[model samples]
Target chain A: MVPAPLPQQLADLSDLVGRMCTHAAGSLQSATAALLECRERLALQVIAREPELDALRVETEELARDALLFHQPVAGDLRSVVSTLRSAGDIDRMNRLALHVAEAVQRRHPAPTLPPEVRDDFAEMGRVAVALAVKAADVVRSRNVVRAIELDHDDDAMDVLHRRMFEVLMDPHWPHGVATAVDVTLLARYYERFADHAVAVARETVYAVTGEEPDAIPI
Target chain B: MVPAPLPQQLADLSDLVGRMCTHAAGSLQSATAALLECRERLALQVIAREPELDALRVETEELARDALLFHQPVAGDLRSVVSTLRSAGDIDRMNRLALHVAEAVQRRHPAPTLPPEVRDDFAEMGRVAVALAVKAADVVRSRNVVRAIELDHDDDAMDVLHRRMFEVLMDPHWPHGVATAVDVTLLARYYERFADHAVAVARETVYAVTGEEPDAIPI
Candidate 1:
């Protein structure tokens, strides 16, 4: 049970965590934006921002942990704060991964051979990655379990999409050659992990409320 | 604060969520088993087990959520339960993703031109996936924050391996066209995500201990 005397502390902690989630989510968005727009400057900025977000993650996690240890909260309170702390880490890593992709892309501009048929295929991967990060942030701040759950179903599509991405790269007729193939490899990874991490944030949210481990769930 | 009357409930809920996580981690291991031994039956089993695990996730999440609504926990309690529930989805998805690769690998024998290489990569990826999954389980059950924090660094290696796997695929001299390419895509996604979800799990663990986000931490 929430201690009647602790409202101010709870609100402060929640707000700080909420901001952490928002910033982490913003980093994800910036990473994808850097990718989609091919803005080297933006990509650099995203990469630069990585350390700050990482710092925030560590900071928030420490605070939550300290609070948990010192206060030894009730079942519900303990679960929520602990998960938030955990999700912050998830959010941070996901953001860093996104930044990694942006930098990888920036370091080597490997434009995939767009056989008119594969027009938006690569772009779609970037879009999805950004979308996943955005959803993860929402899950953290709002703790919307249903929204969090959506990440699971949508992730299958990521598998499917990346498979298609490879197919396009492997096509012998593709004129761009190895560059297209290499680009597919890196970009596909970014999207794959993006979806995976988003689902991670959601899993934590569900855990926050349910105290259930993710392994027990139906796949 | 820790509720005076909820210790039993806390233990019960933690045990339940921990069970789910344990199974989810096992599923990842089992799913990888399909590739390590190249046994189609093993792969099938992993897929078959997914639905059961999925069901567990849903049930536990609902339970945790109900608890949250019914009883407000203090910081530590909230973090514990919430991290468990949150991690459940990531672990589940990781299991499913590994199984996705297993299920596909189960479908066909690799072409001879490079079956050995593909097999090697698959086995390695599976090993990596299982390693991460196992560690995640350890983190949750043992409440090991350092191990959780270490997961972030591990993902970087996963990404490196993914790129190396790609190099093998694009060498052109490697032969066994089209199919090997597909294998690379699938295996790459699986390994990459395995690392990612592991990082997510670790992040949550750190959060459970410390209130910092990734960007905020010095690590």
Candidate 2:
């Protein structure tokens, strides 16, 4: 096939990022579902797919570097290219976090990591985390800054859930022993960090569009 | 003062990356010291310096982006700029991992996280982690591909330590409670991940110098 024009190549790159984002979102969703359901097969699938995400991340970085060298795109175009490159790292991190969740489930096998009392809280975390991942994918697909900007609120919710999980762990009356508590703590962190990466993607998207960071957003 | 030429600017950028690497190394060392000694004040100092790392990271990234737009360097120079940008992220992550170690220490102030039995293991981990980080910084400063390539071996040692830690955790006679186990798990992860980031910087430095990834290096 004949190579397309530079603009077309740029579009292809953006599309590739979108596809990767969708894959990341799917991975997190499936990983969480597997964790909740104790499905080893699903969790294994998520773990296996992580290499694909790593490959895609490498391709994205290579393509971005090539575009910089070949097109020398400047200003907004430059920002967009940089964002595409940087966002791949964020997406890849989300994929790794998802894999961590999957591995946690796989480690416990048929046994659920979460206890009965805290299952609902983690379930809520999984829901919000998957939703936030999907929203992040949507932002990449549409390049809609408004939707991208809304990710922070979802991320904040993830944080609250994270804190609540910690509170449960630190509670004096906590019934779960150290092993289960450790699992829950790590699981909570995986979800929270996943959400953090999603928010990072949003921030990069905003920076790409505006050439400035979101208001009061820390580096 | 007059702004430096592009060559000088590029050198300045690399110097900045080196400075950031040193800071990251220092943070890891200090944080590990805090963990080992259970010194709240030292841990607090490490936490307080994290913002400085964040600022340095942002500055390195900006300098890299600006250099790209203004200088449009190609080939090795372009790779250098990109490496500096990417390596800054690695360094920043290392700093964050260090902060986690420090915070873990601060949270359990006046009491060490690792039990008497595992304290020696973690102390060894801290030592290896610090050494690996220093080696990574040296590679960055010198752009020595051979030295950079050796980091994988150091990283391998870290992985062994990490696995040894898990072995202890999973042992039938393991005596530490879940909270302490969780703390040790996270601390081990922090060290292993810090080493991983250092290896990443080494890999990037190798690529920057040779324009090719090291042979047989698994992604």
Candidate 3:
């Protein structure tokens, strides 16, 4: 049996994933803005739009299966297909978390801002998420190894900010039993985890480019 | 180009995944027993054994890549690898969580057993985790379709037990504060998520046997 070339199949799958990632990137940025800017309508949109991400997941997986079965392409082609299939789900999950943050923002009834320290972290996390998504989208098309690695820095920045945010909320100095503290904890977690998935995408890119899992992100 | 027989590569990769899964099952069961029985000594063993699981993951992925590149396997092989990759991570994460439980147990002064209400849930979860691991192992060796599909039930049972445990713990009457509540929440999450990974393995089995993802897992 002759095997079909895999580059075309993988390219098609990558293209689709890239577009959906764009949607995901857009959704998260919008969701974060809605939260910080007090746009209830936008937050509602983010909450309602989660299904789109799920849909992309199902569709991407199906397409990848079809490609894998049809081509049975060896080597880099197979790696790309498998990686895209798996990474799509991870991206969708992160998108949903961003929407969840937007929902929480809605419930807070638009006080117009997060507490000063917390808001700074949220803003930083949101920035990192958007940049990470853009870099992820970029790498699939170019497979630029160094560019792929850059996304990890964005994730690192988010982690630094998230840790600072968590520290303040969890501090013993903070009055015990504040409801806001709990909210802050969950919020920081959402953003921090969003960064984590972004880091995962960066890892996948390294796998795609180098044919090896790079060492754990630099300290 | 003459390709290797598709079935041969598929069988080989699937078989490798199944064996590692079986080993993981036994180790995880022991890991849980180590925790619940206050066997910190065993816990250390569990912690020490993680490298094996990681090795299994790397091996499974390499095999999956081989199947894809060499034979251009059809739907079933592709799905198996996809599912195996996902499940392998799940298994590793569960191992990590079990290690976490062990560490907590070691640090704990042993004031009391886990609450009676949740103790049953924990025990049942542990039992089912072991059972699922065993069944998944069997699926690997024999490629039994029935056992593969039934993997869903093991996962469902874990989820129900976990949710019930949380509901009980969260009741104001349970007398837990922020710290205690966080502990229970994290523990419950660990088990719930472990079952989820097991269910994922079953889903792969179904995909392998039937070449289709399960439409629904019976409650």
Candidate 2, RMSD to the unseen true structure: 2.6
Would candidate 1 be rated incorrect, acceptable, medium or high by CAPRI criteria? incorrect
lDDT of 1 by residue, B20-124 (tens): 666766766776665656667777777788777777676666565555544656566666556666576567667777677667657663422225676676666
Residue A41 of model 3 has an lDDT of 90
Candidate 3 TM-score to native: 0.79
> Which of candidates 2 and 3 is the stronger one according to lDDT?
2
TM accuracy, model 2: 0.91
The collision pairs in model 2 are A178-B178
Interface RMSD of 3: 3.4
* lDDT: the better of candidates 1 and 3: 3
TM-score, each model?
0.66, 0.91, 0.79
Q: Model 1 chain A — which ten-residue stretch has the worst lDDT? A: A110-119
Question: If both were scored by DockQ, which would come out higher, candidate 1 or candidate 3?
Answer: 3
Identify the runs in model 3 with alpha carbons over 4 angstroms from their true place: A1-7, A30-44, A99-123, A161-170, A173-188, A214-219, B1-8, B23-31, B34-39, B75-78, B99-121, B139-149, B173-176, B215-219
Query: How high a TM-score does candidate 1 get?
Result: 0.66
lDDT by residue for model 2 (A88-137), tens? 87788788888899999898998886688888887888888878878877
At residue B123, candidate 2 shows an lDDT of 83
Off by over 4 Å in 2: A1-6, A172-176, A214-219, B1-6, B172-176, B213-219
